[model samples]
Target: MTHATAPSPDAPLEASATIDGAEWWRSAVIYQIYPRSFADANGDGMGDLAGITSRLDALKQLGIDAIWLSPFFASPQKDAGYDVSDYCAVDPLFGTLEDFDTMADAAHARGIRVIVDLVPNNSSDQHEWFQEALAAAPGSPERARYIFRDGRGEHGEEAPNNWDSVFGGPAWTRTANADGSPDQWYLHLFDSSQPDFDWSNADVRRMFRDVLRFWLDRGVDGFRVDVAHGLVKADGLPDFTPPVGAGSMGGQAADEEPVTAPYWGQEGVHEIYREWNQVLAEYDGQRVLCAEAWVDPLEKMALWVRSDEMQQAFNFPYLETPWNGPALRTIIDKSLAAFSSVGAPSTWVLSNHDVVRHASRLALTAENPQGHGIGPETGDRPDRELGLRRARAASALMLALPGGAYIYQGEELGLPEAIDLPDEARQDPTWFRTSGERYGRDGCRVPIPWEADAPAYGFSETGASWLPQPEDWGPYARASQRGDADSTLELYSRALWLRSTHQLGLGAIEWHDAGDDSILWFSNGPITVVANTGVTDAVVPTPLRDATRILASSPHDEGALPADTTAWFLTP
Candidate 1:
C-alpha cells in the first residue's frame, strides 16, 4: 500500500484536538449491504446478521470505512424492511438483537463503523403503536401516534389531503367503526400496510427518540434516516394539482401543489432532526445521523445537512443521472457548488437496493443496445465489454468525489440486473401495483452472486434464493473476479486504496470542461480523473504540464481508454 503524508500547508492550525461529531462522514466511503442478499448463515437461502458478521474480512480488504446496513428491523417485509413493525428488535429472519451486537462489535474492532437504516416516516401495520392507533377512541393518546381523524365533521367524506401513496392508489385508508359507520381514515404515503406517523404529536416524536436511544445503548454507531424529508406534511388537507405535461416523462408525475413542497421538506421537519441530533451528540461523537432525502435541487438537498440537522444527505442526482461525460460533469460541479454553499458535508451514491444496478443502467452492448436491458444472455456477449468498461469508469469517478461515497452490494463484482423473473415469481409490490411498467425492483434485489460454480452460486446451499439467481451471473461471480486482475472488483479495490492512501478525502475538487462531449476531467489537488462516455476516443486535457502517473483505470490499461472508460491519474 502507498503511504501519503499530509502537506505542510494543508495542516489544520486549530488548537483543540477533539474530533468533530460530524467529521466521521467527511471523505468516508460507505459500503451498503442489503441484509437479505449479502450472505446466508442458516442455509435458509436468505442473508442474516450472522451472515454479515462472517464477511467482515471482505469489507476490510475492500478498504471501506463504514457499512450502512439496510433495515433489519422487525417488519412484515411489505416494503422490504422499510416498514418497521418493531424499531427496537431485530427481525427473526435477519437474526436476534444479539446477532446485531456481535456484528457491531466485530465491525468496530476492524475500524469500521456500522450505520443502520432508520425509517421514521412509516411503520408496519402490525406495530404496537399502529395497532393501538387503529383500535383507539377518537382524540386518544394511542390515536395520536398516527394521523387519524374521525368520520364526522370536516373529516367526513373527504381525506386530509389529495396526496397519493408512492406505491400507487389513495394515501388514506378508511376504517369502519363498531357501529358500522365510517369511524376514521388513516394516511399512508407508501403502502396500505405501512402507515405514516404524525410528527406533530410530541409523544410520537419521543417514541422515535427512544428508538434511537435503544440502538445507541446497544453500541450501534449511527443511523441512516430513511426518507428524511417525508417526516412532516402540510398541516391542512389540500388538493394536489398535477404539473403541466403529466406523465410526459416515462417516470412518476411531478406534483406541483404547495402541499407537496411542505410534505417533503417542511420547515417543521428540521426540529425533529435537531432533536435527534442532540440525542446522538450525547454519545461522545461515536454515533452519526445521515438522511435519505430524494430532492435534487441543491438548496433542498442541503436542508437535511445544515449544521443543526443531519450530518449528510444522500446525493440523488449522482444516482439518477445518465452516465454521460458532460451530464456527469455538470452533476459533480453542481453538487460541489451546492454543498459548499451550505457549508455542510455531502454524501454520494451510484446504486442502492431500491433502484436499478449501475452496471445494468450504464453498461451497453450490441445485444442490449439501450443499456437498461438485462438477463442471462447479457454476460457472454462480446459487445458487453463496453458495459463493463462503463461500469468501471463510473466507479472511478464516484470514489474521486470530495464527500462520503456509497457502494451498493454486488456493485464491486459488477453484478448486472436480474430481468428474467416469471410473472408468477414477481415479489415487489411497487412494480405489481404499477402494472409492470416499472419492472419492479426485483431485478436489483436478487441474491448476491458468490462462488462461480457453487450451487445457486453459493448464495444458498438449499433450494433457491428468495429471488431466483440469474443464470448469467456465473461469469461475474466473486470467484471469477478474484482470479482476474482486470476485473471490476480489482478496479474498485484499486480506486478505494488510492482514496485511502492519497488523503484524497481532504482535497478540493476542481472540475474542468474537457471540450469534448464524451469526456469529463476533474482534479483533486494533484490527482485527476478522466472519463470517456461517448462511443469514440477523445483527447483529455490535463492542466498539469507533467506526464500523469496512471494510478487506476477501469479497463486496466494505462494507454488511451476506449469509449465508456474512466481513468485516474496522479502526479508523480
Candidate 2:
C-alpha cells in the first residue's frame, strides 16, 4: 500500500507511477463481485454480506485495489437486486445495515476500497416513493417523482409510447384504479417492477444527492452508477424506434455509432454527473464514481468522464472489440485517446454480471451473438479450450494496458459459462421476458466453486446454491488452481503482482512495429507485451527478441508465441 503521492491532472501520465494515489482508480485493478453468486454463508442458498466479508482476504491476495459489489440494496428480489426498493437500506436476504458496515470495515482493513452499485435510473415499484405514487392521483407530487402520463386511449388502455423495454417488452406498464378501472401508465425502461425516475423533477435529483451522501457518510469509497447514461429522458419523451441490432449493455461493434435512444444518454445526464462530482469532491481520498454508461462511439463515452463529471467510465469499445489484432490495436488507441482528451482514465472490462463471460465469448462463433445467453439447446457450443486460451491472452493484454481494469468474479479461475443449466433453475428476467428466445445471463452468474470436492462447490454450508452449478466444475475450483503455476488463478496473481510492481498500468504505451497484422507488440516503460492472434505460431518481434520473457499465457516454443497466446517480457 506504500507508494508515491498522486500527481496533478496536467502532470505527465508517467509521473503517476504507483497504485497509491488520491486518484487510486486510475491504474488500479478492481474486482467485480456478483453477491448472490460469490459465496453463500447462511445455508439459505444465497450469498450474504458476511460471506463477502469472509472472502476479502482472497481478493486482497488477488492484487485488486478495490471490489465493486453489485446491488445488495433493499429489493423484492426482482431483476436480482437491480430493481431497488430502498437506496439507503440493505436487503434482508443479503444482510442488515450492520452487516454492510462490517463488510465495509473488513474490506477497508484489508486496504481494499469498496464501490457499491447505485441504480438511479429506476427503482422497484414496491419502493415507498413508487408505492406512494401508485396510490396518489395522477399529477400529484408523488407521481411527479416518476414518469407518469395519461395513456393514448380514451380509457388509458394504451401505453404512453411505443418504446420497448431493454429486457424485451413495452417500456410502459399501465396501472389499475381503485375501482378496477384503467389508470395512468408509468414508464419502466427495464422490468415492470422497476419504474424509471424523473430527473427533471427537483425532488428526484435531491433525493439521489442525499443517497450519495448517505453512503459517503458510511465510508463507502464510491459507486458504480447503474444505467449512468439513462437518468434523463429525451425532451418530450417522444416516441422512437431503436435502430435494428442496437445494443446498450455493451458488446456492440466498436465502429458502429449507437443511435441515441429516447431514453438513453441525453445531455441532461451530464448535469447530474456534474452535481455528483461536486458531492464527491466534498469527501477525502479522491472518492471515485465509475459510470456504467454503455453509450456508443468512444468519443461520446468520453463525455461522461470529463473533469467535472465522473472519474472513470467502462471502456466498452475495448471490451466489444473482437479478438483480431488490428481491431484490438485500433480500440486501444481510440480508448486511450478518448479518455486522455477528457483527462480521465479508462477502465477495461472483459466480462460482468450482465454479459457472457469472456472465456466462452472468445470461443464462440458469430452465431452466438453478444448480450444473448447460451443454453443446452444452443446449436454452436463454445470451444472450451480455445475460449480459455484466448481469454487468458486477453487478460494479459488488458493488464499490460495503461489504465484501470475490472476482473469479474471467478474470472481469475478461468470459469466458462455454465450453458447447460436446467430451464427451471434460471432466474434472470430476460429469460422469461423473452419467452425462451434468449437464454439470459444466468449462464454466467452461477455460484463460484471455492473447493473442488465440497458440496455445492463450497458455496454454502447446506450444499444449496441460488443457482445450480455444473458438476464438472471441479477442475476450475479455486482450491484446485491455487497451487498450480499454470492455472489461470496463479497466472492472474503473477500478472497482477508484476503489473503493480512494474507500474505497467501507469506507463504510456509505445507500440512496436511487428510487421505482421496479427501480432500485437507494445512497450510500457520497462515491460514488453506481445500477443499472437494469428492462426499459426509467430516469431517474437525482432525488436524484443533479446528481452527475457517474464510471464506467458501459455506454454510455447522457445522463439515463437502460439496462436491465442500472450507473453510479457522485461524490456532490455
Candidate 3:
C-alpha cells in the first residue's frame, strides 16, 4: 500500500537540521504562476517567460520554495495554451525555448525550483499526429494515437456515445471521412480543439515518455501533470450520467467521496505513473511529480501519490470544503491521515487559476457556491470585508498545517476575482462552449496588480492588460501591501519563513481544543496554530495562554484575538 523511501533528517535541501531536501516537497511552499496573468513583457500585453525570469526576485522575496508554471508549450491558444500542438517548443507569444531556459536559470540561481505544467491527456487538434490522422484513411496507423471511433447512425452523423465535454456539448466530434461525409468521431473531454489521446496506443505512450525526458534534460525540477486522472477511459466507452454535485473545477468532482467513475481513476493510470517515477528517479535534483487531479475522498486522492507514483496531488477537496471550523478541521485531519498512510505529506491549498480567489470565496456557502460566475446584476459581488478577513485567518491556519502549501499568484495581495470583465474579454472556452452559462475562469486569470497607481497597475508598461483590470485592483497592488506589517502579503511571507525554519512541517500535530467546534487548535513541535471561527471572540485557551504570541492574521495586541482570527504561538 505504501512504498516511498522514508525521508532522512540529513537529506538534501534541508533548510536547517529541521527540514530535509530528500522530502523537500513535504515542507516546501510552491507558488503557482499563471504566466499570462503574472507579468507582461515585450509590450504584447501578455506575460512571458522573460517576464517570469525578471520577477524571480519578487518570488524569492515571497519565501516560496518553487514556482509551478502553467503551460507555455507550442499551442493554438484555443484553450489558453492548454491545447498544446508541440510538446517541446515554447509558444512564440510567451517567448522561445531560450527564454524558458533563462527563466529556469534565474529561478535556480535563487534556490527556487521550476515545475512546468504537462498536458499528456490531450493535444491540440492541429498537432502533427492529429493532422496525419486526419489525412490518413479510416483505421490507418496515424489515427491510432487518438481515440477515434466509427459513428453509429445511418449517415454516421451521430456521436459515438453520450459522453459530454467537460466544457459543454458533445464530447465526440465527428470528422469528415475521405469522401467528405461525417463518419469517424474523435473524443475531446474539453474543447473540440483539444483531441484526447489514446493511452492504449504504444506510440502515444512512448511519445509522452520522451516529452518528459526533453524537459528533464533542460533542468526542470519537476512537472505538474495536467488532467492527471484523465488518460484512461472506461472499456467500450459506455455511456453514464455524471452524478449531481459533480465538481466544476478543471476535472469533475465526485457525486460522493471515494468516487467511482468510468472516465477517471482507471487502474491503468497508476501503471503509467510507475513508469514515470522511473524516469524521475534517473534525474538528480530530487525532482518530483505533482498531480492536478480532482479525485475525491482524501484516501482516493492519495492513490495518485503512492510510493512509486507522484510525489504530490492537488487537495481539491480541501479547496472545495467550506470555511466552517469543524469542516475545515475534519478535512485537514482526513488529509493528514490519508497521506501519512502512503508515507507522503498532505498539501494545503486555497486558490488557483481555475477556482475563485479564496479571499472572495470564503464568504460563500453551499447555497451560493457559484465561484466567479458573474451576471449583469448582483453576480460580481461578495462581502469583501467578511471574505478577506476570513481568508487571512484561514491562511495562518493553512500555513501552520503539517505539510506543504501552494500559493496562487495575486492571492497574497488579497486580490478578489475580476468578476466584471465584459463578455468580449472573457477567454476561457467554457464561456463560449457553455453559451455563457458558466462565466469560466477569466475572473481569476486577470493580470495581477504590481503598483498602486501606475498604468495597468504596473503589470504592463504599455497599459495594455490582455484582460481588463478592475479599478479596485490598484488598492491591492504589490506596492501598496509589500511592507505593511498586517498586510496579507507580509502574513504569507512570515508564515512560510516560520514554517520552514522552525521544523513545523516535520513533526506531528497535536490537537489542543478541537472539541470546541467553533475553534481549531493544534501544535506542531514548537509552532502552535489557533483559529476562531465563531461570531464572538474566543478566549485564548489555557495551554496557549502562557506561550509566546509570534504573529496573527488580523491586527491585535498580544493575547487579545478578535473573532474570525487565526494566531500563531511559539510553545516552550
Candidate 4:
C-alpha cells in the first residue's frame, strides 16, 4: 500500500520543471537509494516501495532529477536483491506490483523520473529456469538456458576451470543426480546461489528483452545495468591467471578492482547493449541506460557509452582517485576527453552502496588501503574532521563538473561510514565467504537517519532497522541538518539549485592555470570553481580574486581559499 506524506512547505511542486527535455539525462543529477536502508514505512525494519513513495517530497526538496533504486525484484535475499528469482515481479518483502506503480506515480507527479537496477548477468538458483536446468538431462534443452558443462577430472569431481567466484571459492559448483552421483558442474561468477545465464542461448536474449519492456511499460524511465560488462564470457571457458596486484583467482570486489579478467568486458557485451538501446528507443527518448561497468583504461570504458550503446557509465577511475589536486585534475581531463570521443556525457559519483562513504575515505592515507569494511579492529582510524572537510570540498568540486552526477543517500547529511559495526551483524557475502578475514560492506549500508531522537533515527516506525545505525549519528540526522545554513545538506541544496538555474550540466569546462601544483581551477559558463588540496592556504587566482560574486564555498574561507577547500565564484 502507498503511504503518501504531506508535502513540506519548502518542497518544490514539480521535480523536473527546470530540466531540459529530451536531453535531461545528459547532465541530470540522479540520487541512488538503497531501498532496504532508505526508509521503513510498515515498521518491518525493512524499507519498502511505500516508504520510498512517502519520501519523494524530500527528494524533490533536495533538487535531484531522478532516483535510481537498487533491486527490489523477487529474490531469496541471499546476495541481497541482486540474485533475482523473478524479473517481472516485485518482491513481497518490498511490497507488491501495485505499490511500485503507486511509487512511480508519486515520483512522476513530482517530476522525478525513476530508474531501476537491472541484474542481467545472472539469476538466482531458485529461478524456475535454473531449477528446470538442474532437473533435466545433461544435454536437454532446459539445461541449455544456463551454462552447464562436464567436470574435467575423473568421476566428474573437478571444476571446469580455475576461475573464482567474486564472493570467494570456486566459480563452478557440482550438482548431483537423483542417486547422489556427481553430474555436471555449473558456472557462477558471483555466488553459488546465482547461476549465470547463457547469452549464447537465443532464449536468454529474448527473455531479457521482454524484461526490459515489462518495466518500461510499467513506467520506469530506464535501467542502471549492474555489471554491464559481465554478460559475456570468453569462449571455451579457458583458465585465468590473476594479474599483478589482482586478488586470488583474479576475483575481487568490483568497486575497488578494475574488471580485467576474461569473464569481464568481453567484446560481445557491446552487442548486448546495442540491442538493449534499440528497446529503450521504442519508449521515451529521454529514457536512459547507465552502466555500472568497472572496466579499466578510460578509453576502453568509453566504449560502453558509445552513441549506440548506454548513455553513461560510472566513472570508476575518477571515483577511485586519491584526494590530490593533480591526480584529480588528470582524471577529470581524461574522463572528459574519453567520453567526448563517443559523444556521451561523463558521469561522476563519489559514494554508493558498494563502498565506504567518502566522508571517512578521504581521511585515510593512500598507504592505508580501504578494504571491504572497517570495524573496531581496524588499525587506521579516519580523522573525522579532516575527512568531512575534504568530503565537503570534493562534493563542491564534483557538482561544478560539466556532466551528470549521482548522490548516494545520506551524502547530503555528511554521514560517515558506521565503522564500528559488530562482527555478528555483518551481512555482506564478502565477509562470510572470506571467513571474516574482511569486514565487508555492512558499515556503509546502515540506514539513513531522518529524526535525531526517533527510534532507529526515524528510519522505521517500530524502532527497528535491518542494520544497526551508529549512536553518534543523531547530530547528522536530516531533522537537524535541514535548516542549518552551514550544514552539508544546505550546501548540496544550494549547489543543485544553482546548477539547474545556470544549466551547468550542459556547460563546457575551461581549465585555468592555478600556478600551484596543489591548486585546481576551472570555469564552466559563468561559474569558476577553485579547489586547494594542499596543507597550506592558497591565494585565489588573479581573475577569481576580483570575481563579481561568491556562489559557494566548502569551508567559507575569507581572503584566500583555505587548505582542502573548494569555492565557486561568478565571473563577469
Best by the lDDT measure: 2
Give the least accurate 10-residue stretch of model 1, judged by summed lDDT.
245-254
Error of 2 at 260 (Å): 1.1
For each candidate, the alpha-carbon lDDT, in order, equals: 0.74, 0.87, 0.83, 0.85
For model 2, residues 495-558, the per-residue Cα lDDT tens digits are: 8877887887787999988889899999998888999998899988776666778888998766
What is the alpha-carbon lDDT of model 4 when measured against the actual structure?
Answer: 0.85
lDDT per residue for candidate 3 within 1-572, as digits (tens), equals 11112122123333546333447788778999999988888877999999898787878877788999999999999998999999999999899999999999999988999999999999999999999999887788999899999888886777888987888788989888678766688999989999999999999999999999999999999999998989999999988677666654333443454455677778889999999999989988688899988776678889999999999998887887777788888888899999999989999899988777888788755333323354344444677888899999988888888788899999888888776789898889888998888887888889999998887898888888889999887779988887677678878777777777786766679887645798888888888888998877867777777777777888765556678899888877
Lowest summed-lDDT stretch of 10 residues in model 3?
Answer: 1-10
TM-score per candidate, in order? 0.88, 0.95, 0.94, 0.94
Q: What clash pairs does model 4 have?
A: 15-110
- Candidate that beats the other on lDDT, 2 or 3, i.e. the better one: 2
Output the lDDT of residue 480, model 4: 90
Cα displacement (Å) at residue 39, model 4: 0.6
Best by TM-score: 2
- TM-score between candidate 2 and the true structure: 0.95
